[model samples]
Target: MSDMTIGKVAQAVGVGVETIRFYERRGLIEQPLRPKSGGYRVYPDETVQRVQFIRRAQHLGFSLREIAELLSLRASHGTDAIEVRQRATAKLQDVDHKIERLRHIRRGLMALLDRCPGQGPLRCCSIIDALEHDQRLASEPAERKEPDMQTVRLTIKGMHCDGCAEIVRHVLEQQPGVKGCSVSHENGEAKVAVDTSQTSGERLAEAVQGAGYSASLVTEAG
Candidate 1:
């Protein structure tokens, strides 16, 4: 075939051929021509332009769903600069929210660090005591339980907003034997119910902390 194919287009755009198919499936790119002479795939210069636009939007942090919407809008009448600005502004708000929450965690952790010099028994350590106390407090006020469910509460710190809760939930779900996890930013709690025989509270707590959130297991099993 004289004209380039999907493989060639993908190589030119630094993307996998499967990505090109995905873009087509997502309606971000139209199907290329099948030339009569060889019935081979053929890509025009415009296909390259569309591919670059997709890459650029992805680099700008647009989700695939969002990019598809933008591409649809463009195909009809093109997107307004105002709409682009609005999407960007919304993303900024999300980033700002995360930053503000992290700042709160940093302040609390720094204060705890300052109070405790990090050299003492686990019981004598102020930070550990504080963590335990906070964990204990978070365990309360969720007494109601659904049928067929066992409740376990974790005391987690460094959660600034609901997004942190999502992060906690996502991290916990990855662990083996973990059934499900629900994190609450308002209560500073991560409520998880898992197979006791497979997963331990200490291991789950460590996983939560590893996801950039501070957490500890409370002694109260109820």
Candidate 2:
């Protein structure tokens, strides 16, 4: 096929012009050199196929980074199919894990809904009470106890936004024996206080991981 201008490439690929530039910036696609005559840069027909491949991979839940790796594998000579298969298998496992986490969230929401009368005043609403109780527990200090109290610092990954930090905080605070937690998406960390007799640092990390983010105990102190 003949080479086409950037506009034609975008039109043919069903994406905006900026999107093509974005792909170039992300290293997912290469931008052709400008013509010596000072004309627009042309794109080869292969660019269309590559952009389509990226879109299809995204639809299948693969992130841009993963798609780049797939493209690299495709461009490599003598690459085995196993490499591609392994990536797909790993992606499938991630999807399954997210599905399970969503199921848990749905069940918890349903339980709250079942307990709610749906028409009561806000103060007496089961849903409101449940949410308020969590907020209070996360902020309030735990009562004095005989058991030793410990604080653990956790480094987390895969949190992309503020909402992710909130989810991690909720998961941490809901754990048994947890007194409070502070989570920050920017720093990708969580500081949790718990009663050592009821829960351990490892268990807290596992709880965060179960919520779909990677977590590891960084430090623990009594």
**Model 2, span 1-222: residue lDDT tens:** 689987888898799999989999999999999989998898889999999999999999999999999999999996655467556766765787778666667777777878889896788898888887763222222333454456678999999999999999999989987766778899998877666789988999999999999999995342
Across 115-145, the per-residue lDDT of candidate 1 in tens digits comes to 7967767778888888877732222222322
Q: lDDT scores for all predictions?
A: 0.74, 0.82
TM-score of each: 0.46, 0.59
Task: Give the number of colliding residue pairs in candidate 1.
Answer: 0
The CA root-mean-square deviation of candidate 1, after full C-alpha superposition on the true structure, stands at 20.8
**Clashes by residue pair, model 1:** none
